[model samples]
Target: MCKAFEEWQEECIQKGEIIGALKTYKKCSFAKEETLKNIITDFSLSEEDAQNCMEKYW
Candidate 1:
């Protein structure tokens, strides 16, 4: 489940809060989708992850 974290990374950079997100991602040991979602949620920000996936893939 080694998906690209580019979108999540961009989001973090845009929010100017990558420190915590990096910490959490590392803490979770980078468990793919769930951890990514956790990172998104941990920031208390909203991103349509599923929609982004669909738009990018489908």
Candidate 2:
């Protein structure tokens, strides 16, 4: 929980690296669409989150 929060914060603050963060998150062994949904839901993010993140960072 601590680690997840920390990573989320990093992704939020480090806008230029959000795509890398998302890719890393997606590639994690623990990743799943449901988990991703939960993360986005918990953060109140949307598909724009991924798109904007990629556009800004990648």
Q: Please tell me which predicted candidate would have the highest lDDT against the true structure.
A: 2
lDDT of 2 by residue, 1-58 (tens): 6999999888767553444556666677444555456446555678667455545533
TM of each candidate vs. truth = 0.32, 0.32
Worst 10 residues of 2 by lDDT: 49-58
Q: Mark the 10 consecutive residues where model 1 has the least summed lDDT.
A: 49-58
Off by over 4 Å in 2: 1-28, 51-58
Model 2, residue 24: displacement in angstroms?
Answer: 9.8
User: On a 0 to 100 scale, what is the lDDT of residue 52 in model 2?
Assistant: 57
RMSD of 2: 8.5
TM-score of predicted structure 1? 0.32
lDDT string, candidate 1, 1-58, tens digits = 3346887777757555545555555576775566556646665545675335323432
